[model samples]
Target: MVLFLKRMLLASLLFLLAGCGQTAAPALPTKEKAMKVQIEINASVPNKQPTKLTLQRQDLVHKLYTTISALPVVTDPNRPCTMELGPRYTLIFTEADEKTLIEAEAQRYGCRPVIIQGERQQRDTNPEFWKLLDQVLREAAPPATVQKLALLHNGQTALIDSAQQAQALYDALIKLPPVPEGDPHQPEKQSAYQITFFTAHGTLSGTIDKQYARLEGNEQARGGSYYVNDAFMQQVQDISKSAHYAPGRPDALTVTVSGPEISMRSFIDTQSEDAPIMQQLYTKITRLPQKAASCSTEEEKRQKKLTTTSLHFTQWGLPLLSVEIYEGEHCQQVLPGPGSEVQPDDEFWNLLHKLNR
Candidate 1:
């Protein structure tokens, strides 16, 4: 009976030892060297978005490598897997690994593992694409390349000859990253403005969206959209506001004023060499009051309709300035000109009279 008890105790002790020995396997070793790595998660499943994580730090890269390595690899070839809901992972390591450990480790984490071979394959395969893009960058580098820029917004055009603005725009374009192909099924938002880069070599046009820019076409005929950084877009807005009217040589200046029961038009010819007077006229025309007069009664409201005055300055048979003015009901009462009863002691009326004479 003593021997039987001892045997039973020994058997139980052995059983416990066996169970302790079958503990979980240890984690795999990680690569210690620094590496330029990019991990992309491409999900084909609905509502499962794709993500990309780039790592340059040695410690972080090692941690990521080890984490993937620890996962159990899918061994069964017949394992129930479908590409439709694929959570495929692509791991790109700049340094070549003879053992392909990273690829094997990535396989355990996703449906498939893709390894990038070298830098050459990462760029656009077409040689002409590179040449055209490089040419654009070169042509857009110098401020002198752009002679004139036409900015159109809300049916109003402002022609500018600012080198600072042109340089800012071109620099932003050159800094744009390579465009990635967007999902065809996804909808694209409308662009805010269109900028045409006129260089001596040729013309390049593009549209600027909130977060992206679309280059219309290239010499290779490869047109695409690229990501625009926030800093670049902000710079574009800052410089674009520099667009304003600058006085140019003109052949004639025509002024038209229309109000409730009043309409008057006048013209000025530049052949008279009225530079000083014209400058004063330009200043007065642009600085006209824009607010409408207040009226409370029905009769006053009927008489208080806003007045619109336009100054058309033409140069070499072309229109230079198409200035429009919309002022309150008191425009006729306050304006100093042929149609107004109140003639103030300002030179505005005198200049108008001289131009018309």
Candidate 2:
């Protein structure tokens, strides 16, 4: 009987060990999922300012929520902790409606608990909490400042080199709302100005017409034709008229597509169903930071059994700018035709591929 009891106890212990191995971490309790979160962060040291950010996108909020929810709860009532927290983050979460705002405070120091203030609960998930916060802040932060602004107006172009002016102009320009309905102040001859600015986000372009600059909602800026207040709009116009401005002209585009799935075709478009597409392609090509380079060894030997498209850009009587692209990642390049290799922004290459298809 003694032996049997001992065996029974051993089996029970084994079962409990297996169960413990499969146990998943419990998350902070919440009734509803959040689609957005607001975070405020600051350092414990002096002379620094706290920064506030609101993550409005759903995907980002969900990632942060997963980390927050997985935080292990602290059950010890009298846990010892260091006196001062090194870095602190106050996170406020309220997405789709619960009873009240849920706030969590994350601190760096001994016992490092992430406290959900309302529930009066603490979680021992500081390591992961800080790691995720670091990544999110880096991504959510915008470029420090605008360094250069390039404007294309009426076939004339100007490049603004003053960082201060570019920063001020772009900040103001991006905030203007779309022109309102039925207003009476129309300019006699309004010409559109195409402006491109360079930042950490890569090349971005927008258009300006008289007192309004039309900014398409792209990944960076909210899209709309924002009305540039008179004072600011006049400043841009005056800059365009300066001696630094240079004369230029728009180029015409011709696309020829020959592929297995499609017949030989060509477009000599300036103003038709294909005009906008051609114009956009031409504009993109002119700015591509492209040069000739060979493809990978494997790609070099791959059979060129795909469709080919060629674009020829012309300006009045100037020599034509010609390039050819294969339907697939062909050479992963746009060959400067008559020559075997050249580099074009893969983005531009992809755009043509979709259009040709």
Candidate 3:
């Protein structure tokens, strides 16, 4: 099943280049045209993971539109001119002739223009689909969800009441999936699920007898289960016994749950500071749902890369729902903070209360 999806994705990408609007060649203007635009990103932000490209664009205006459309931060694509990413962030457009369309797009997306030295020569373009995706991801954060979140007033930085809000906003921004390219007719297919849920208790450790059977944590305070693979369960037991840590109260426990149906799994032990158990759980949960072919050469080395699966949770944190994804590895944890808002339009206090608790 996983191999079938991989083959389908490859085939869809080829069809996208030949037929779809995503990678179609730019329509040549009736008259001769020459414009040059170059987009350079810092790429290296401290303590941040590398951003992946999602889609490509040839024309500046279309590129901007494509970028906005691909953004995962924007919950409502139709919402007019919502800028939730950052204040100092600049969208540099080095066009020879003033292109009102692209500039208008920048303004609409809450991005500003910075003049750079270069000829606005028209060339083949593949806009950074990943960075734009990060922008749309901020919708779930506090500064975005709060009653009167700080709007971008002029200049490079937007003011917020606390650093936590900024970090939360960044977190939401970065967690978006890459913009998919290929034939829209052929639906995207996901490989197996390899999800890991971590906490502070290492109480339950054993190999399960079957695949898709529930593996529950032992302690009452830290009990949860998901349909997982038999081989994955064995691997967890082996890793746990080999792992050696100074035995105090277990500060963090991680459970590795893998299969075709697992999503993001996590256990927040308010009791402990270090979450080694949770770390191991994350490692397993992210890996179990993947196939051998999906593991990249690098991931094969560490044996801990997870596929790009959806992160769905059970209401009130019970019986979490797991979804499959394309084969890739990422580290994303979504633990509701103290004062975490239950709904999208709740007070910021809900977030504070959850994270602090």
Q: Pick the candidate with the highest lDDT.
A: 2
Model 2 TM-score? 0.35
Supply candidate 1's per-residue lDDT for 84: 41
How does each model score on lDDT? 0.50, 0.62, 0.30
Error of 2 at 69 (Å): 21
- Index of the highest-TM-score prediction: 2
Q: After superposition, how far is residue 96 of candidate 3 from its true place, in Å?
A: 6.3
Instruction: Show how many residue pairs clash in every candidate, following the order shown.
Output: 2, 2, 53
Please give the distance, in angstroms, between residue 3's alpha carbon in candidate 2 and its true position after superposition. 76
| Residue 195 in model 1: lDDT | 63
- Which digits, one per residue and each the tens of the lDDT, describe model 1 over residues 169-221? 66556558756434343324535655655555455566676767765433312
Q: Work out the TM-score per prediction.
A: 0.28, 0.35, 0.19
Per-residue lDDT tens digits of candidate 3, residues 1-357?
A: 999999999999887664422232233322112232222223223664322122123353344444433332222223344455432222333334644223212221232322212313212212454344233222111121221112111111122344344234223322323223331433213212211222232222211223332213221121222234454545434433333322122223333344334444444553544244333333334333322231233442256454332323221122233332233334322222222211112233233223223
Distance from true location, Cα of 29 in model 1, Å:
39
| C-alpha lDDT (0 to 100) for residue 304 of candidate 2 | 45
Candidate that beats the other on lDDT, 1 or 3, i.e. the better one: 1
Can you write out model 2's per-residue Cα lDDT over 135-223, one digit (the tens) per residue?
Answer: 55544544335677777666566678877777777777756664643556673253466776667655556667766675433324334
